[model samples]
Target: MKMEFDLRMTQEQKLIMTQQMQMSVKILQMTNMEMQSYITKEIEENPILETEKKSKEKKDDIDYKELIKYLDDDFNYSNKNYYVNNEEEVSPFTFISAKKSLKEYLIEQVIDLNLSESLKYLCMYIVEDIDSRGYLYTNKNILAEELNVEISTVEEALKVIHSLDPPGIGGVNLIECLKIQLNKKQITDKEIYLIVENYLQSMADNKYAVIAKELNISIQEAQRYGDIIKTLEPKPSRGFYTGEETNYISPEAHIKKINDEYFVIMNNDEIPKLNINKTYKNIIYNDEDEKTVKYVKDKINSALFLIKSINQRESTIFRILTKLVEVQRDYFDMGEKYLKPLTLKELAEMLQIHESTVSRAIRDKYVYTDKGTIKIKDLFITGIAQNNYDDNVSTLIIKKEIKNIVESEDSKKPYSDQKICDLLKEKNFNISRRTVAKYREELEIKSSSKRKRY
Candidate 1:
């Protein structure tokens, strides 16, 4: 037997991702605000692109009849108008005064107290060290080393911070924060203070009987003190801004019902229309130098690709939403209860596109429906098997059912996880007791014992 090396030639077909293709994918995944920022940056960098301006004369000559006809043809909906202004008017005072941060508020209170220059400086340092949750976790020794002072001095500064206007602003932990608030309020109940300091875990677990026995009190008394402790603020800086502004979500599409038929509408109007600059186009056509011509050609190609990518993104999103509405028509007619289980793979197969393409199309995108603004991805949910129903139900539907059951339960004797599981089974959801507990925890619902009231 002999071994010989054999060589053979074979042709293979492979797809390589081009730079423009990558750009298109990136643009497809960007949210509305992100796409706006990206386009603005591109326009500033490239001299061959400009945003198209709408003329007042053209706007004035708009025909309502033709517009309605076009919409009817595209969406197969009636010409009934449903647009209404739902935005509430904001108070002028809201814009007049900027929000005061937790740090600034603390600093202002510190200024009102008379202190030595060194102490005031130390107080400022402590104030700055407090986290967004209004808790100071920095070690006194480390702070003293940084400020070139004794550990006792840092401790003194912390004490001063603990006395600030927000009762629990400078506490080191949840227990300490509660103690600080209790002390500030002059709460003289020794049992309440001791429970907060020692048996907070037992209290959270609803071991009220054990706590009462340990403290030589009745379970009712323990529950009454626990209720008082619940009134304390866990997050002292909740109302204060942390140098971050609220982000407003803009829906990328809309689903409207007209005469019992649902229609999908893409929000192309929010995006600015872009076109190649006439001057740059003329320069590219008239150029003779190879280097200058190449530069202009590259920029022009980039601008063209960006514009095409924007249009393609919108078209792809519209197609995906159209397919979604077709499949989930029951969801649109009824509510989330009727939402069917869907997956990117299934939708991609229906559209004859890659699963990743479907993912990119729905990334950070939202849709406005009769149910209000909802993330596009939220529409796709995994299905769970049901004993009674022919088809599987969505996990979201199960969660909604669990939430409803908990909401309607008696507060004095809340349903246990096992009881909840039995109730869901009666409703056709054959789920286990453990799964019910897991879903309950995910919904932030406490255990039956913890939810019990005296």
Candidate 2:
């Protein structure tokens, strides 16, 4: 081997992620509330940036929608009354009021029941011991021993606790939870009680034949009663305030049809519309201290870049969504069932950009459509070969079909994965058995063995 060293000129072109490009990418991905918060922080840190005041003048009876640029000098998206038809929507906090928590509600009911002092104190102790899942975390025997009372007395308190609102609030276990709710519903069927007590595991395993042998019923009847059990709530605390905060969705854009034309509409009510401060602009030009002038200029450039990046984000989102309305026209016109096969790569190519650019443009962004407010990325669906006619099927549609098939199949003779594949093929879907199994799993449908009745 020989050691060699030489100075040579090399030439190769490569892509580089610049600061401005990074900001553009970041702004594109932020949700509406996120963008608003980001702009507010930027305004606070940069003296050159200030939020432009919205005009208070009224424009009456406009009653129309149009697609337009967001950052133009004539931007009027802030006129909520004119564009949104006085929808008068407010922030989620506006709807927030003091709510009574589950434990608090339970304690209040126990107090109002006017029970004897001993029973009241016992009920209060049990209510305080209940967890957020509505389960009595402490054992009844343990509580009885602690209170120096009999187990029957604790059970009597438990019966009173279980009789409160939200039917299953004080159940000690899942089985007890189901029984409490079923009791409240007045379902006196012996078959349901047996299934709840002795055949729960068998029911879960779809051993309806074993259940039928024990219950003296047909397989069909077992299946029917099992179906009823599935509807019961396992978590009694559902739909109640549990001290957990909820994250609300605020859509970034509205896709509306105006006179048979689709438009990307945005609102600036919460978003800060930024502009350079005239005082800072004057200081930059006249300040004697070079350091001060330099600082002002740097801040001004930063503010301008931020504003430009935000504008670019709005425009890019508008163009992509406008094109989406064209590419996924069937989806918008029909529903989710017609959402065609599309990928970020394919959409990037169609828009003459990189895949990462499309990915960033849709990241965390929400769009309001006729169907519902949905994440923008959900519009891009993976495509599958639908049939001989070359039609494409969305994986969403495939999952939907799998769910429908499972729901409609005979419970006593459930179809296997292969049988489900054959059924899809009969309906012009060309997926394999494994693919069927995958989609079935995604739909949370169990195997044929587990789905079958006795």
Off by over 4 Å in 2: 1-4, 12-23, 36-165, 170-183, 186-203, 207-226, 240-247, 275-302, 335-338, 390-404
lDDT of 2 by residue, 1-454 (tens): 9999999999999999988677877787887778888998887788767766632322222121221121123233331221321233422223335556898889899999978989999999998889878889899989988999999999999999989988888888998899998999999998898899888998888888889988899988998899999998888887667766345467666777778877666644567777666565456446799888777766766776686677767767777887888998888888898888999998889989888878887887777777767888889989889788667888998889888888999977999999999999999998999998888887788899887654
How do the residues 26-111 of candidate 1 rate in per-residue lDDT, one tens digit apiece? Answer: 99998776888888899899986777773223333434234333221222223322222232222111222455788999999888
Per model, state how many residue pairs clash.
0, 2
lDDT of 2: 0.78
Model 1: lDDT equals 0.80
Q: What alpha-carbon RMSD in Å does predicted model 2 have with respect to the real structure?
A: 7.6
Q: Give stretches of model 1 more than 4 Å off.
A: 1-7, 13-15, 40-130, 136-167, 170-173, 180-186, 199-220, 244-248, 254-279, 404-419, 446-454
- Predicted model with the maximum lDDT: 1
Error of 1 at 368 (Å): 3.4
